[model samples]
Target chain A: MRLTYVFIAATMLLVHLSASGQSQEIPSVPLKALTGKHFDTVQFNERENPVILSFWATWCGPCLKELDAINDVYADWQEETGVELYAISTDDSRGIKRVKPLVNGKGWEFEVLLDENQDFQRKMNVVAMPTVLVVYKGKIIYQHTSYVPGSENKLYEKILEYSK
Target chain B: MVKKTGLLFLGLTLISNLSNAQISGSLESTGQRYVDDNKIQLDGEDAEHRYRSNSYLKLDYITGSWSFGVQGESYLPLSLLNYNPELKGVDIGTVYARYSNKKLGLDVTAGHFYEQFGSGLILRSWEDRQLGINNAILGGRVEYAPADALTFTFLGGRQRVGLGFDLSKGTLYGANIEAGLSDILAISTVDISFGLSYVGRYEDYEHRYLNGNNAHLVNSYSGRLSVSKGGFYSEIEYVHKGKDLLMNMGAPLIDGNKKAGNAFLLDLGYARKGLGVNASLRRMENMRFYSQHDLDGNVFNRGVVNYVPALTKQYDYALQNIYVYQAQPQYQTTPKIAAGEIGGQLDLYYKFKKNSALGGKYGTQVALNTSYWGGLDIEGDPETGMYTTKALGFGDKYYNDMAVEVRKKWSKNWSSVFMYLNQHYNRGYIEGKGGMVNATTATAETTYKFGKSQSIRMEGQHQWVKDNFKNWAAATVEYGLDQHWSFYVHDSYNYGLDKIHYYNLGASFSKNSSRVALSYGRQRGGLLCVGGVCRMVTEAAGFTLYVSTSF
Candidate 1:
């Protein structure tokens, strides 16, 4: 078993050296849209402009605040940068039922997907809620964790830098 | 010599092909150092270990349609207080390899995997580190999406219950199928979907109490339907479980105590633009199912086969969380012989338009939520262990909560949130002690942003209760130095009785996908919940360090 692990490690290292900066592709985990339609997250990379995936939950206070702040300026940002944002809810069965009503109640316009078992979250290596990532052509360019009061602006700045 | 040369060539070829693979992984470690304090003292084994840590590292390598991964975990010396004692030492916790082909409409996984079927009433295998519940299955799973509107899944495995791939004796098998009826029928006006699921658990018993009538297989089946048109939607689910042996205090009773279980859940919602309303009603009776029969009703929530979280409005403030509710789905005969619980919750969300009376210069968001739960009315003979319950009735009040919240932004630099809540918590029934306590709580939070990326937030909260822990007051202040750094100081005082101050101060730094946080504080011993699932944590004064990074 130890020798097998060594061999696997060597293969991973070789792959790492070859793939280097070109990897970081968005995983193709299966997901469900708020409308209950099947969705493949890999489709995110096929978009023309940079896409943002925000992992959040209905019960997380900071996540709500962050999304609300971004919602305020989302229209303007989209018109300017032609960017899109996907609010990926990691609410398991307990809270998954409330996500749609809450999102609609808040009047958020971003596309929403459900990660019922958090498979998409785990595949993305997200350890915490309110983790936002910027991807262009399936490759991650920027990411951030947690949220402060005025942190949305910094995120927008990164979006602008990547959009151009 | 010839075989060695062939093997070397094969290795070279494999290495060259894997060069196209991409690797991603994450690491998280949390360490704590306990301190001796007069107010809160550690006892027994807890005192023996002054330092403890829990760490996990996961690595995934993907190439085209094939991907592989492994998760290694370490709980050295000791894991965090309240964690499962079985989860000790370092070992490979989970391993998996998968092949997914979107074009072929097929996905297969061998090793450890997580899954959920139809709201997880019958089957759900997932992980929650905070709650110390990682019951992923170690076996095989296959998913086939033959068409855009139809999908089927099948799985069989043994549940992991401890560290280092430890598995439960009982074997689990499940099958599920979902169909989008609207799309198949070419109905454009409304959307309709349907699903069916079945889960079975098999275990061999060798105890003398067993009888010829006892069966090793326990089967559960579920049916679901959902319909939506425009902004209106509704979903309904029903589950029936075959008769199985009943357990009392983690031990199986006589075969005569075998009982069957069932559950019903309904959800309705309507939303558009600025207004949204949703309500959910659920009833569960003897619905607790576990991977291992002997491990039933365990404190660590291990070897669980389904997800049954409390349906309540999860609070954001510490005071509001004190009287949180946990789902009651077990049958008990001590003190009260109750079977299960029935309850529902309603939520309403409305946004006041901008430049209006309630909106001022900016819009204001208002949310109102309420929930109530009660025990199932059951009539039975304790000696015979036979019980009968009505389809719908409240035996005893378990919990109730009503809350209102408003969020507003006065300006670009200033924002605030205010909330008020009322609760009725039955301590005696829920926690096995004390009596009913009525409580009311209110909180206010305000944030002021200055400079380019700096902000300050202050919050005040107060809870009024006449029994069980009495009244409490708390306050918090957080300062953000920049986009990547922040500091916070929080204190919750039990002025009504204990006269103890649970003070905590913490700072965090984050850059990209990495975060580091350090804190020194007195942990308030109680149930710490995430996503409505909870774990009991002991009171302790300590310094904690947390670090996480992903690449």
Candidate 2:
């Protein structure tokens, strides 16, 4: 009973706090590509097209599942929704080397970016792997964490909703 | 407490008044209840605490280029293992305000923040809650990007010591600049980048040596270059640090002052449609970088400001990870500091053509890899923590590993993976056990799909070692029913000698944006690792729960 009471009180106190996601649509954080090029997320979506930013890593099992699911329908989703996906690898410097080889081996067709320093991950306040966010213009309209096979449908639906 | 409440109130006021503003946050909590068991005691861990919970809650308010946020963490009565004994009770993790303008190409951050420079060799301020570590800078940082091709950053802050802020430990200031040459040169196919960093740590204490008097300043410099074009890539970084005293972690602490720490790292790789190959080399000499100067130099705790991960391969197989490699920070566990280690690794991957005899309908992927590490050759005074070394001289082999793996997609419904590894580990030099360990590990895994939404996977692994638990074997099975529900059961046996069966069972469910998993098991815990940094997890029999969600 005491634990539950504390949880409730803390939740109430925390409900009043808000800042990270609601203020901007797309942050200006710089992410490194596998090819050593840097992609500024702010200027990445030049067309103002709906963007799907997915944060993941090499060692995350659920992330691979989510990416594989998205890959199955990515082309069709792009054709219909005019959306572009950026797979940001949250791997640290030690694991960054696996990015290119793994991506090529799996034949994933998304623009892969490396966050070796975790600067972007920290700025966005991402807490879990396979976190998917739907951004339009500069605002994050929908965000989801974790992964289930059917969850990809929800992401696609959010993309379609924001594309309108 | 008053400060925290004030910041929350200010954030709330801004959100309530601004229709154009937005606020969002996330929550993560893990709870464990321990039960006494004979096996845990046999593993030599004192289970004095019955319950432990670690939780974090964050809130952010943002509008346009301005943002502010606060983070709160609770270790409850005590933490699991009390990784940082001072990390108990409710506390504030970070509070910060930030502003970024894309048009002006400027960013400013004040309060608590995280930053890293050039691979974090010389400077890095960050957090890893799982490791019970958070060394974020508590001060101000400014970033200027006058052009698309060049960027500069300046920051000055005191490192977060233990659970709270300590001013007595002093401050660190750093400057970094990076040039994206490819962006300016308009090189369509080739990319090149260069970076330079300078970090100085200021501690006003009576050194009476090196620079003489108190107020010791340690300066470190790093330069990096990277080139990547399509499938070929190469990158290198070199770091040098000035003379300073530290609580030497590798040896018994008695005022271990070291001088001129340095390191070099290089990576090369190429990948194509069906092939990928990579090679990497690294050498470090007395390269222990820390923000604090008065620690007794014990591993895991004392608030390290930078992360120098073990440069060895990270394995996913349960048995292969047993004899893990930890970076020997200046010849671990000695009275006098000595040479650091040098090592290199090579990886090759090739996929067979589809419809080939071995590939069948889907191609088979074959991967081979090998890695070797050895102590640097050196002759230096140990009492002063000074050393000299030749790169790749290979004084004594500390670790060696070779492995081969094959992955095959047998059919639309089934897939399998097989792997084998051979390793030689110097237990005396690496794990500080005063001996040697030669081991071979083999593993097999398979997954079967049933219908559209169900699947089953199984794994079996075994390790043969001459020392410390002669042999070990484990088997795990997981069943996924529908897309949201999963169940798993596992058992590991030290059949070689201890002959103890460590058993576990768990289940999890995921829907939409949330996931909850609960497991009950006996953790004959030894070393638990993630991303090359490891800590010794205590043995215990417990029920554990993990929960997380995002907005």
Candidate 3:
């Protein structure tokens, strides 16, 4: 019976691999919004505008620093480039409680998503925390990992590049 | 025949849906070939399974508001050295079906799920592969929001203890309700919310010493209230537990009542413009509650019914992580005394002007953090299993840390970060090794961007201590080309411990959501931690490889 299950799993993997030849976008997964709504990654926008997804966790000190830096200039960036920033929290059940309180406390201005299982983070092949990636028109335009204090400015530059 | 047909039918249906649906998943496989190491034991006879591999394949099918996912894991022959051999095998790890409707304000998940309530002080169900812990409940969960201001969540199921389905069964169930008063009151000046949660765990079997009469059903309750207005915010949570007999009362021969346990947590923050300050405080006594009756906290963190972790800073630097504080989950059951802990942490962050004297070119960021925790002043008689404390009075200090960090960018292409940390760790009380050790660590990291798609980063760190591995130094350099290739070399030298050098060289390549890494390294055998949870990391000399891909 276990062998049967393995065969079925392998078959599914092969089938899915064949279908994965197309252009890459953000990983298609359902994550909860801070407002208790589930959002599909593929249906992000009505148009192919640039979308910046920054994967972070509450326990990650660098991630919070980067997010806080971006939060300071977030409004200006959004106004200029019309780029939507998704601060994706990869914190699981243990740290999920801190997310809401911290978000509200910090008064962040980005759309917050919960990847409690890290399904989206795993699909995106994020190797480390504080990974910021820009996706536009079904293609990954830019990605940067391991944020230093001033690394957020580089992310803004990439966002502007993709917005254009 | 019927089972095979059913599986085939399911596979075909999923495969057919893959043609049009947006299906994404990931596969991660980590393989290691171990060699004998002098520091960590590996050769006598138990090391027959010299090759260890841990692999996970996850598939998520998301169609609009509905999502179905499955995870399969394989630990061939043996799991990691830290992981129990009983968990070695290939099996379907988890499978779940979930549906969410924005219009109805409802979300539901069935089969297997993870959940938490209010900082996880009372309840938390999660999975951490590196820690070899996956306490995801095999059950059903529902979240409902009748209005935008109110939300309710409920879950009930047995926890997955080991690889198989029918092993050492235990049940965990919880429900939480939260309501935002400002939204319901139609006011914007003040934002207030309150939540209440109840969690219960039951297992038929109990430790022989603890006696089968140990409360078959244990309950924990939590209440939280949060208030935020303008730049000021504060949140508090209080948890109370019913009588739990599974707890060790100074070697299990206690005669009297082990009535209840309690914890109180408070978090306050104020952030406005470029300045932010936050503080957290917690007091807990006899709060190490588990689902089953196994002592010493179950290996791999399984059967943990509640989560209470260290409130100290989780440092990212290597040396800063050496003296990390772990929450005292279990009461100190020594012949001398028995007590819990009371502790807190404070953080202050400020940024200077971009062109100011202190800020230089890109601006300066200064962060100061301090945290400390100590055992409570309580005395317990083994015969009675009772203790008294001086009402929030702190006893001997268990651990404390002070840190300051400064970050500045010199130019568009160059950036630097410097950090210093001083820590005092009571190993006797915390880790049960050296008596007490004081350490100071300093680290400097620099990053230079060469071109639009090329960058190099390097870091140097050193720690000085008077005892226990007196001094340590680590250095790492990494070069990366935007999204395709990254190579890194790192070495950490322990000057005191036989002058061993833990070294590694690795490179990773990623394109369009798939990545593979190869490395040869020597790992230091010690306690590796994840979110305040600690597990043994065996010293190893090996060649390692990792592959992760998403489809």
DockQ of 3: 0.22
State the lDDT of candidate 1 residue by residue for B400-518, as single tens digits: 99999999999988999999999999989988889898999999999999998899999999999998889999999999999799999999999998999999999999998889999
Model 2 agreement with the true structure over A11-129: per-residue lDDT tens digits: 55445443332444455678777776667877644556788889998777668667856875789998897899989998887777877876776667788999887877766768777
lDDT leader:
1
Clashing pairs in 3: none
Q: Write the per-residue lDDT of candidate 2 for residues B300-376, one digit (tens) a residue.
A: 54546556777666777677877888776454335334558888888877777679988788677777888888887
TM-score of each: 0.95, 0.90, 0.88
Off by over 4 Å in 1: A1-19, B1-18
Best by DockQ, which number? 1
Candidate 1 vs candidate 3, TM-score winner: 1
Model 3: how far residue B427 lies from native, Å: 0.2
Q: DockQ values for all predictions? A: 0.49, 0.35, 0.22
Summing lDDT over every window of 10 consecutive residues in candidate 3 chain B, give the lowest-scoring window. B249-258
Q: Who is ahead in lDDT, 1 or 2?
A: 1
Residue B229 displacement (Å), model 2:
3.8
